[model samples]
Target: MRSRIIFFVALIAILVGGYGIYDSVLKNKDKSSVVVNEIAPQPKKDSVEYITVWRTLNNIDRGESIANDALKREQMLLTDALDEGLRSDVELDFSPSTLFNRDLPQGALILPEYITRENDPGYIDLLVTEGMTLYPLVVSNKNLISDFIRPGERIDILTVSSPSSNLSGAIEKPIRFKGVTATLFLQNIKVLNMGGEDSEQKLKPVAGKSEDGFTTIIIEIPPTEVARLALAQRTMHLEVYRSREYEEPVYADVRNVMSNYIGIEEMRGSKNKNGREGEL
Candidate 1:
């Protein structure tokens, strides 16, 4: 009986020691797993690849030449910049001969599809940019228009009108005066087509004067100014002034026209009253 009890005790002690060793091993394994998880770096959810590309610094109009300072380099996400015709080069140079084919908003990515070359077919027709209107005007003053006028040149429009009384048959005011007035109608108007053909294709180069005895020019102007231009053309004679440099916008200034009117009045007054053909 003693031997059997000793045997049972020894068996119980062996089972307890084995169980303790297994528990310690399990605890150690759990600790190692937690340490590994804490040390491993986690990936960021917002991580992405980016590339540097060219973007417009300001809103660029169609058919406008790209200036060197007009473009800026910016970093954009790769997914956002992955267009087939996208201009991806950070060091790419814009050519002076190329022009924007469509209007681009500020910060727009430059692309090959957005540009047109000067030698392209129907280039003159493409000079009218978006939000602009083309107007055809008949001009008879050859002395004002130069022979070198061509598309892409800027010109100013003016009107000459004979003075009429503002009073509609009312009692004439004491200081009432009638004279001629020359007014500036429009400024910085762009020429698109001249003489029914591209200026480059003309053989004789007779601009502003042709066999028809009048010149028809197609010009580009703002949409809002179309009605004003039409009214000016219908009311009085229109003339063009080509300047070597652009001038600031100045609406009808009657002072300059009045000076000419005074000169004419002085000449008429200097003549003998009996020799005067009619009333002044």
Candidate 2:
């Protein structure tokens, strides 16, 4: 009877131990389910912001330059910049007083790429206009103010040459056309240099060649006008007259030289003992 009682007690202890194990397992399962249902924590958002930048004050037209007064400062969120490529006032190192390379509407951001600098070729190139070219004219004392002419001075150019070979088929006649007549060539052209001032070796007057030696002056002329200049210089003597009016261009193209400049023909073709053309 004692053995029977012990066996019954063992069975009851086993049942209690099994129930305790089952309850612990169920508790752990419930905790895992609760963790799975909870939402994931989001990454912290960036809070730092606010950037101040310069914007155009008015409508900046294409090819129009920007002045200091053309800009105004405004604040924007740093986090919301247009892109990583957008330039900020801090990143740019240029003067506000620069020409805009392209059109910028009013209230537009002043981009660094929109302005031109002195180092750029386009900056220096702007001094020359369309359909125009810079040509260097070699000059001498033929200009009354040759010694006094400077780079920025304006002057008039005249040509004295023999007219078209009226003596046709007169070749083998021992000589070509005799340059004598004078005409108005170019007017009011800007002179870039005088008396070889920009060169290391200064030009000295040619003693026995012509009355004055050769000195070169630079001039700007249109393409259409260039042919006239070349024709004059190729077969004629070129002389300069100072422009009286500084602000206006003057042109006088007269075909009749005998009426205007009397006795010039007789003065042009005289010769020295060396048979060289005499100085005017």
Candidate with the greatest TM-score versus the true structure: 1
What digit string (tens of lDDT, one per residue) describes model 1 on residues 1-280? 9999999999999999999999999999999999988966777798777777778999998778767799887787777777534435455436554678788999887875677766677555566766788899767644345556665677778776545533211233424345545567787787765645542553123355532356667788898998877776665566776644436554443456466756655555554657763335
Clashing pairs in 2: 162-179, 206-213
lDDT of 2 by residue, 1-280 (tens): 9999999999999999999999999999999999999997999997876666778888876545456677787777665555735434334434422456777788987666777754565753443445668787765443444345554567787665546433211222213233445546677886643435423322232222344455566677888887777665655566777666445333332334236444554676888989998653
- Runs in model 2 with CA error above 4 Å? 1-120, 141-147, 164-179, 193-212, 245-280
TM-scores, one per candidate: 0.44, 0.37
Q: Give Cα distance to truth, residue 32, candidate 1, Å.
A: 62
